[model samples]
Target chain A: MRCIIRLTLLEMLKKKILYLTLALTAIFLIFYGIAMNYGYDSLRDAEPLMRIAVSGQFLSMGIYALGFIVSFLSIFASVGSISSEIEQGNYDAILSKPISRYEVVVGRYIGILLVLIPYATFFYLSIIGLNLYFGDGVVANIVTVNILKSLSVLYLLPTLLTSVGLLLSTYLSTMGAGVTLVILYFCGMVGGILEQIGHFITGEAKVVLTSIGITTSLVIPSDIVYRKASSILYTTSSGMNFSADNMLGASIQPSGLMLFYIGFYIIIMVVLSIRKFQIRDL
Target chain B: MMLETYNLTKQFNGKGGFKDVSLSVREGEVFSFLGKNGAGKSTFIRTLLGILYPTSGMGLMLGKPIGDVETRKKIGYLPELFQYHTWLTGYELLYNHGLLYKMKKNEIKARIDEVLKIVGLEGHEHKKIKQYSKGMKQRIGLGSAILSDPLLLFLDEPTSALDPLGRKQVRDIIFKLKNEGKTIFLNTHLLSEVELVSDRVAILDKGEMKKIGTMKELLHSPLMLSVGNCSEKIINELKKIDPLLERVGNDIKMSVERDNDLPKIADSVVKNDGLLYMMKRKENVLEELFINTVGEEDVR
Candidate 1:
């Protein structure tokens, strides 16, 4: 298993896509920093500004950007993990060794996650740096929580994508899996929006629609987790100052329950992937 | 049996797996699996390697049940269409597989060099597989298969894409491995290659094991005799002596029930025929056996 993981990591590191992703994320961060610096210079008022508010907003934006980046990168990285091997007949060569099929799936997931870590860390740190630069050190208190939120998005979102990617790789051809996962990511984002709209309508139909949206989000939780992480970063920086009367509501605060849901969602997806892989012909 | 299958059956999308096929390979012997394209050669190999699950029935490898991971450690496999991660050079690929087999780093290095030399790929170790020719890739594939010094090796068309010399090189390596007391389960359509290297061969057609035995066992036991340029009158006269005598293109083809009857048929053919161009017992010898067992349409 260790050997498998090592081989997988080495193979993934050599992929041109991984370096391209890292370069893109770094470029985004540099531009983001320049934009934030300009925005801070424009706002001259400096009377004990809510550092938490500024930091939270910055971190939220970072989470949102990183979330999408990670999701897209993971989809492209993982779409071919299994399917290409099968198509090119290398799956037989790999599986013919003394390795289990489950190890192959899990090892690939871990390898992909390892490749994504540097980009996630770069984005997370850039958000922290941006907060310190713009908020004039007021963002220091909740750096831990902000980092935690970024880490959660980094860790959990990819886990979710990995599972979905594995499941898709099992059933779809490489290109088909890539396109389907991208579509599913968008659908997940739309589902999150519909849930918010359902809250506004306030009826039995609204309740049903919200329930459906929640269930659909649970099925592919990339968007939901991103939103949750964004909310956490936002509230943490703002010190939870906003009243409950806001249009989005204090109910939008990141819930521990959602984190648990994402955890369980990943477990179930991985289980389904394993089961599907076990029965499917290679 | 070092390896055995009990009525192993597999169906893909409701079609194309062999049914009720039973065969075995004994230890330290070369067993050839003969089949044309889509004759389930790869399907059977994958099942044995545990890459594909058997839809029905069972197989045992190295005296244990097939698909057992522990059992697989003792086995080496060379897939038909070998494709390694293109990023890896030949040496890296071999070293990686050696590591998987738990060889020490230095030992892996040594073995990589050794196997590369044995496969006639000595100086090409640093070259990436993407840059390799098909025949070079095949040598690397064979190199990996033998890297672990496994007790059993499963080679699927080990020389299918090779030049004549390359094919001979592969065949020599196979014979050498067999001489080293390793069990080789080969899947190939090259009858002459199989004849030269295999101690036994099995013919599979439409997912069934139509025949299985040593070349001599198959040939002599089936009691086939091919005679050329024999007249129809002599052929009929031979048929009168032995009911199995039949005309095969102005030649007499007969199935002898016993070995002792071969001489009698030959004597009868010569005595009655105007002349005998050639007369020899055809014991389903590799090519004839393959064509006979797999059928003419399937052989091509």
Candidate 2:
């Protein structure tokens, strides 16, 4: 198991994609910092405008940046975890050793997360640092909350995505798995919106549509978690507002219940993935 | 039996893989699994190594069920078209594999050097696998397989990418391991290599065991025989002795039905005023046996 983890980490670290991701992440942070400074300068005299605009912009940037980073990284990292190796016939060499398939799956997931955590941490810190430098003084408590929320979402969301990716990669070819997961990721993003539109038309029918959307989101949790995390980061002390009508409407900050749902979502996806992989014909 | 399969059948959905294939390989022997491309050679190796599960039936390695983790500890494997992490140097790959086998770091380092030397990859240890040529990668792969001195080693086309000298080097290492009491399960299409190294060989075609036995046993079977040149009239005379006798060009080919009849045939041919060009026993070589049993259509 340790060998699998070591090998996974070593292999991922050498991939050009990892460096590309890191470079993109750094760019996101720099851009966010500049954007926050410009917004802060515009409303420098108005305290309420300064606070709302700066906090809202920083929150939005954090959500977008981290969400995109985690989604992109998870897709790139996990989609080929098994399929590429199997395609290249490298798994033959590994499985021929005294390791079980379960170990390989679990070890690879953890290793990918290990690589992801550092990037997430860097982005989370960059957002908070930019908020302090440009906006109000570092609300250590708020920053801590925001960072914790982002980290949890980072960890839980990718775990779900990685599990889905691993499950797909186990049976499909690399390209097939990759394209399927990308489609799944996008569907998950639109799922909630589709459900709400269904609700506006009918009630009981909406229940079924909502459940379907939730189920789809559970299968690929990137959008669900990202939206939930975005809502949480944007929510202020006043109240949760996701309405497009209110110009001041900020996305709801993820509440305790939302966080728990994300956690449960991640666990269930991981368990399903592990079960599927154990019985898979690798 | 050091390794055995019983009624093992594996079938892919549309296409077939292996079916009710059964054979045994004894300890300290070079057992060659002869098959052409997609002849279930790799599928069998994968099943034995726990890379793939059989649809039905059973196989045992080192007295344990096939693919058993404990059984794998005592086994080593080299895939036919092996791919290693290109970022890793030859030494790192060996070291990493050594660690998986639970070798001490110091022991792994020492074994790394020894195996590198054994595979003739001594100085190139520091070079990344991507930098190595195909033959060099194969040598490195072979080195890793034998790194732990496993009780059993499974090699799939172990010398497919090697030149003559490299192939000889691989064969020598296999032979040395066999002499040291390691059971080797070699899967290869190289019949000459099998004939040169195998104590026993199994011919597989269309996922079935077509033939299995020691080289000598296979050679002495009715499927093989020795013939000497004799006069056409004598060939006609021998036809009286045996209905299977036939003359082709300058030589008389007689199929020996029994071992005792060999001396009689030799004497008759000599007395017939014919020169014996050669009297050599022939068995289907691994390649011929594979084709004959598996059918030529299966060999891509």
Candidate 3:
């Protein structure tokens, strides 16, 4: 399994997708860097409160964008990790080894994550460093604890996407899994909207909408994770926003159980993937 | 026994997979599977390797139940038209294969050099698999299969994609592996390869093992005597030696399972005043046996 992990990581690096991802990330950072260097000058010159609001806005947006990039790369790395190889008859030699099916899938998953977590960390933290360095002390107003909290929550996003991607890869073709993941991504977005809808409605209608949101959350907790991470920015709040009160996962107050449930979702998907792949004809 | 299958069948599709394939291959011998396209040769190997589940019966590989990790560690496989991770360089592919077999890093490094040399892929290690030619790909595949120096090696069409030179290169490697006391289960359509290397051959036709025996047993050529000016007495003399001797066209053909019988037939032909135009043993006897077993239509 260690060999698989090392080989898979080496293959991913050789494909240079990681480099391309980093290049895209660097370009994104450079664009944001420019945006901060000049675009925030006027905001900084304004009242201090306005500057704080502007910095909060960019910080939240940057976290979401970074999360999306990491999630995309993680999915791409894993979506074809099993199904495509089975189609091409590549697993015969590997499975003939002295490793279990679970090891094959887990080794691959860890390989992708090993690359992903570090890349996500670098991108996630660099933007923070850049904002602090370039934003004329405006971005420093958000508590460091909040930034770290948000970053930690944001980290789960890709791991969750990769699990879902590998789960679908177990039974579906590479393209089929990719398409299904796209639909699930929409479900996650809709889940976020439903979570928002639960805030404004009341009575049985409120119960129904919240139930639907909860159902979607259980089915695909990735969107719930995104919302919960945003809520961490302002734990005292219930809505998803980049306000100073909710700038670092503070007030939106989703139960810790939901986060653990998301983590469990990752484990279940991976286990299911291994079981399915173990019995597949290829 | 290196491998023993008792009624091992994988006919889930009930269309093209093999059935009731029971055989025993002793250690350090080369056993070959000869069959036409879709004749269940690959199916048999795959089932034995546990890539495909058997619907019934049992298989024991290296005296352990099939698909056991301990037994797998003692086995190697080169799948038919197998695909390699193309982005991987040849050396990396072998190295990774070694890792899968749980070899240490330094052990894998040493084995990679040895395997690459054995497969005649010395300088090509650094090149990525995608850039390799078809023949090169096959050689690298062989390299990975032998990287662990497994006790039992299953090579399916190990030379199918190679050119003549590459084919001989593979044949030589198979010979060398056999000399090193590896039990090889080879699946190939090349009858000549079977004749040259296999100690035993199983001819599979339409998912059935139609015939199987030692190479001498399967290719036991029937003595063909081309004669003219033959008389009834000469025919009677030949018949005495081989009760089933038959005259076809201008010659008398009979199974001369013993070399001593050859002399008696020649003496009978001359003493009885029959002109022995030729008394030659048929070459490519395995080819003839294969065609006879599988039928001529499928061979073409």
On DockQ, the leading prediction is: 3
Per-model TM-score versus the true fold: 0.84, 0.83, 0.91
Candidate 3, residues A73-156, lDDT tens digits: the string is 777877888888887888887888788777888888888888888898899788777777877566635456666787788778
**Ranked candidates, highest DockQ first:** 3, 2, 1
List where candidate 2 sits over 4 angstroms from the true fold.
A137-150, A192-221, A227-255, B221-300
The DockQ-based CAPRI class assigned to model 1 is medium
Task: List clash counts for every candidate, in order.
Answer: 3, 5, 16
Q: Write model 2 residue lDDT over B1-300, tens digit each, in one string.
A: 889999987788846688888898888999988877778898888888877788899988888998788677788899888788888999889999997887789999988888988999989999989999999999999988898889989999999999999998998998899889999999998888888898998888777788888876675333222344545666766676677755556655555656677666667667887665566445554556667677777564
* Residue lDDT tens for model 2, A65-180: 67666776788788888888877878888888878878887888888888877777777667767876776642212435655665666566777777778777777887998899
**How close to the true structure is residue B149 of candidate 3, measured as C-alpha lDDT?**
91
Q: Put down candidate 1 lDDT per residue, B4-102, tens digits, no spaces.
A: 999999888669977777898899999999888898998998888888889889988888888888777788899998888888889889988887777
Question: Which candidate has the top score in TM-score?
Answer: 3
Top candidate on lDDT is 3
Q: Provide candidate 1's TM-score on chain A.
A: 0.83
Give the TM-score ranking, best first.
Answer: 3, 1, 2
Second chain TM-score, each model: 0.81, 0.83, 0.86
> Model 1, stretches more than 4 Å misplaced?
A46-59, A135-143, A196-213, A236-238, A241-251, B220-285
- The lDDT per prediction is 0.77, 0.75, 0.82
> Per-prediction interface RMSD?
1.4, 1.3, 1.2
